[model samples]
Target: MSEVVTRTERPAQRPVHRPVFLTRRRTYLWAAGAVLLLALPFYLDRFWLQAGLFAMAAAIGATGLNLLTGATGQLSMGHAFFLAVGAYGYCVFAGDGADGLTGLGLPTWLAAVLAVLVAGVAGGVFSPIAGRLRGAYLGIATLALIFIGQHVLFNARDLTGGYNGRDVPPLSLFGLTFDDRELVVAAVPFGSAEKLWYAGLVLLLAGGLFARGVLRGRPGRAMNAIRDHRVAAGVIGVPVARYRAAVFVLSSMYAGLAGVLLALVFQRTVPEYFGMTLSLDYLAMIVIGGLGSVSGAAIGAAFVSLLPQILTRYSDLLPLVSAPGTGGIAPGEAARYLYGAAVVAVVLFLPGGLVRITARRNRPTPQEDT
Candidate 1:
């Protein structure tokens, strides 16, 4: 088509490097896992099912915080505060309000939704400190929030029910009350645990998928970039502070969601439950499960959530080692000691977390490939 002796222009092309690991095979596996989760409550017993429900909640919270700390390099020691906000928020909005200042008397579901938003706003309020701080300094700032939150929780008598803790109304889904185990699953016997288990499973899966989306998407890349080199990322026009603040707030929202689920499971909302210990436990869950990995978060959540109960059942099986001050090996003391040791053992050997251990079994090594 070009005229004789006419010069032809060439289209410019750039080399594209696509990651081979992300294939259709991986997506299918993920889908299967999600499907399995949905069907879990159908088969499991009440205790296991309830444990699973709580584990998923913890896993969701851990996954979000992991994104902030492990993926985005931001530390938060006040996560329990956000969780407490969620728990109490549900209680406040849904409870009878013995004093009656302003109770929404809203439906449990709607109240829960409002509670999650309140938690997000609470996080947003602390965004500036989180945005400005880093490392131990950030931890200190967040720790202060947890303490301050506890103080406010105690002082806000009209709102928080003052130390005694307010009762959480049983959740109802579409004219069905969840409290009456008999009503949880009308047609099926042994359905309440299974029903709640299924509910927890769905929320967790949704949370996991959401986490996966954020981690694998642009924001995830940006978070990783900031985590690796903040100044460099900033130089490249990434809004580092904005992302940090946003993530902290987002993480808090995740924590709040977990709290809502927690209240649902316990059927009670006690501010004391969301304390420093719980914050530590959540951090431990991520570490033991695998930081920055959704699979790890779930795996870790199951482990930490179930460990206490499992160990408590088997405490008598272990050699009784009485403490220096204790007469008989106190169940509480034994549990604490065992828990500390468990954390130590996991950190010492499984530093990469339980996921790496699980994955290594299936993934071929270079030697195997050769």
Candidate 2:
């Protein structure tokens, strides 16, 4: 006999669309942030403005490093090498050449572009190493870059000004010298602080946007594929070597851009600044901020750069700390201990880094709804 007729009704489904109010809320938040940034220089002193600039620079550098180590699954412990290339590159092209080695006398803007390009070349040269290397070996290979960069800086006496280091020329835009700490900008009463704030904001925006673009588009897919399995990606017709090298090169360029801004803000380029410690510090930031995430890198940069100031300010209050050249544990020493502990805690507890922590908190649990 045929089966008896017994039919079940299917449930209707609704298409998923984001709430309009949610979009509006995000838009409003972004507008508010922009307004706050624009008004910051007016209310802040030069010191505050400078701090903001430094934070932005570090964020940019961290963003690039994050792309390589976090996203591309490559471990690079020598990103500072690229930063050094950028700073020295700018100093060479725009600095006053007392010894006549560099000082091409090019416009600061042009010099900045060239510096970024040179940094890209440096990355390209290192790309093969990244493509062929992995794990501890990759870290060691990249580490060599720091020493190599330092040697070049020290020995390029004609260009780098040896030992003492050389001064960075003030950045000029269409005739306006961005160097003036006292100068005010248009529509802002406190011009100098405003100008610097705006400059930093612009660069940060550019860097963030570029990173977002890379991670959201086709290149991002390639990066993820290679990161997941280089051999498998190659088998599937992915240009693993080319993509790896390109990421390395692009990441280096980002580091260079960061270096150019850093030199401009500090008004000097010293070979000693781009040491192995700087590279390690950046790695710490990536670890603390969250690997493979741009937002995490930014948060990491702020923490790494700003924590020292807070620690120094409060070191006197701590029982084990004292000022340098006067008595107990040096202020710097105490700060280092604090930073080291923080790093250890972060790694031991949150291996995925700060991004995951934030994500976890933001996610809605059944308990949360209740």
Candidate 3:
């Protein structure tokens, strides 16, 4: 018996304890950002509030597009079509027939819900085409939706109010109405923009969280598989066509919700606003922000949507960028050119869009202590 009793094995190394400050850094940042956003309405003017609301709506729409085009590799050039459906659908559902337009006289909340569902149905109607097509083929097929939607919107005078569009009924829920009723809180008069600010924030947060969950789950994996390799994914038992169709429907619903929010913000729906140009703008947002990511879509939406507003606000101070109808380039046009260049730059150099910058900064260093 060599010493009969074996020495108890000790751990290979001491357990490492991360610093509390280091561990809580993300929580602190999130808290600070939340506090800042919540406090903005108190300090900012109506213009800024409205701009923020627009960004939120754009983020919602862009996130959906990212899911279809970015995550699932399905190209859609008719996102604006679904958005129009949602906007006009809400108007029709909640109009009360008082404005000389067709309406169902439904509650505003119900109208909003129904609008989203209608958009989903629209997507479902075209899902077969989506299932059969890919790349530019799918894009062209979807492009047809934009033309069809435009025709319907302009021709259906009763339901859509023709080219003039229709007024969006203010939402009433939980005894709180989101309108320009001038509710005062802490001495600040809460107008429609102010009231809708919180609602927009809530919607954006919920949509982002839901999208993130989808991306982190099985559906996301399936979408990615289809995106990366359709044939391989099929071989692995993933239903490529079904996933494509489902994602399309999901994306359309997102666009619908965003359209509803935008209608609320604008107080009126306009057919001209939801056009091919609008669809292109959404594609630019996902490209600039980083595709297949909620944060990416949001960041891109803010960048694209806010640039024009910022330029317009400071047109007098900025060189070569002037107010609309001025001698020089208009802020809107200039903003578009700038972001268009950004898209090219991202594709050539960054390849991951704006979100990659944050991801890189947050990534851990291999040399760091465990």
Best by lDDT: 3
C-alpha lDDT of candidate 2 relative to the true structure: 0.83
Instruction: Return whichever of 2 and 3 wins on TM-score.
Output: 3
TM-score for each prediction? Answer: 0.83, 0.89, 0.94
lDDT of each: 0.80, 0.83, 0.93
lDDT of 3 by residue, 1-370 (tens): 5767678888698555544555588679999999999999999999999999999999999999999999999999999999998888899998899989998999899999999999999999999989999999999999998999889988989998888888889999889888889999999999899889999999999999999999999999999999999999999999999999999999999999999999999999888899999999999999999989899999999999999999999999999988777799999999999999999999999888999998776655544445
- Residue 239 CA error for candidate 3 (Å)? 1.0
Against the true structure, what is every candidate's RMSD? 6.4, 3.2, 4.3
Residue-pair clash count for candidate 2: 3
Model 1 clash tally, residue pairs: 0
TM-score of model 2 vs. true structure: 0.89
Off by over 4 Å in 1: 1-44, 98-102, 184-187, 190-192, 316-318, 321-339, 342-348, 365-370
Clashes of each: 0, 3, 0
Lowest-lDDT window of 10 residues in candidate 1?
14-23
lDDT of 2 by residue, 325-368 (tens): 76788865665676677789888998888778766754555443
